[model samples]
Target: MGSTYRLQLRNQAKPTDPKHQPYRFESVLKVLNNGDEKLKSWKVFVGFRNDEYLVSASNAVLADGTSLPANVGNGTVFAGYPMTDLKTAIETAGDLNQIQVQVKLLGTQFGVKPPNVPLPETIQLANDVHLS
Candidate 1:
C-alpha cells in the first residue's frame, strides 16, 4: 500500500459498555513524504466526528502533549518523537520503512453504526520547517 492504515472496531462478545459508549475502535495512521526530498518537523492532523474520547496513542505524541483520555472528535494533530523529520527513500538508501511514522490511536463513540466507516474524516500532513 502507498500508505499504511488500520481501522477496527472491537467486537467483543459484549462490545457494549457504559463508560462512554458501546462502540470501541482503534486506528493506525502512517504519514510520510512520498513526493518530497524530506519533511522537517512534520505533523499530521487526523479528523473525526461525534466528539469521541481518545483513550490513548502510541508511536507519536500530540503537539499539545495532551494526556490520555483526551477528546479527539473534532480532530487532533501529532508528531513523531526522537525522529521528527521524515526522510525519503533516497535518504534512507531505499529503506522505505525508515522514512515514515506509524501512529496508533484508540477511541470510542456511540453514533457510528454499520454501513459507515469508523475512520478519520480527513488526514492532513505538513512540515513545520521555515525558510529564513
Candidate 2:
C-alpha cells in the first residue's frame, strides 16, 4: 500500500563486555514515506541511559562523557530504514541505549546529484542509472 525507505546501519567497533567485547552490528529501518520527499531524522526512543546520540554515519556523545574509541563518528550522513533483520544485530550487540547513532543525511544533502558509483550488472536490476 505504501513505498518503503531502507535505512542501512553498521556498528562501529567498540569494547563492551570482556567475553563479548567485539560485536557485529547492522540495521535497516523501513519507514512509511509521507508525502514530503525528506525523512525526518530523530533518535529512536529505545530507552537507554547514555549521553550518546545518532549524529550521522556515526553516533556521538557530549565531550564531557566517557569517550569510546571505536564509537568515534565517521562523518557520514544516512537515513532511517524500516527495522528489519538489522534489529537482530543490534539486539545481539547489547541494549539499544548503549549504542550510539547519528542522522545520516539532511535536507540539502537529500536532493544532490548522484556520484559515479560503480555497480555490477546484477546489482542494477531495474531503475538503476549511470551517474556520469
lDDT top scorer = 1
Tens digits of per-residue lDDT for model 2, 1-132: 022223243232354444333323232222222222222332222211122233323332222233333222222212233221122223445333322223232111111122321111111101112112
The C-alpha RMSD in Å for every predicted model, in order, reads: 4.0, 18.3
Question: Cα lDDT for residue 86, model 1?
Answer: 76
> Please, what is the whole-model Cα lDDT of each candidate in the order they appear?
0.69, 0.25
The list of candidate 1 runs beyond 4 A from truth reads 1-5, 12-21, 128-132
Worst 10 residues of 1 by lDDT: 11-20
What is the alpha-carbon lDDT of model 2 when measured against the actual structure? 0.25
lDDT of 1 at 79: 71
Please list the residue runs of candidate 2 whose C-alpha ends up more than 4 Å from where it truly belongs after superposition.
1-17, 33-44, 48-132
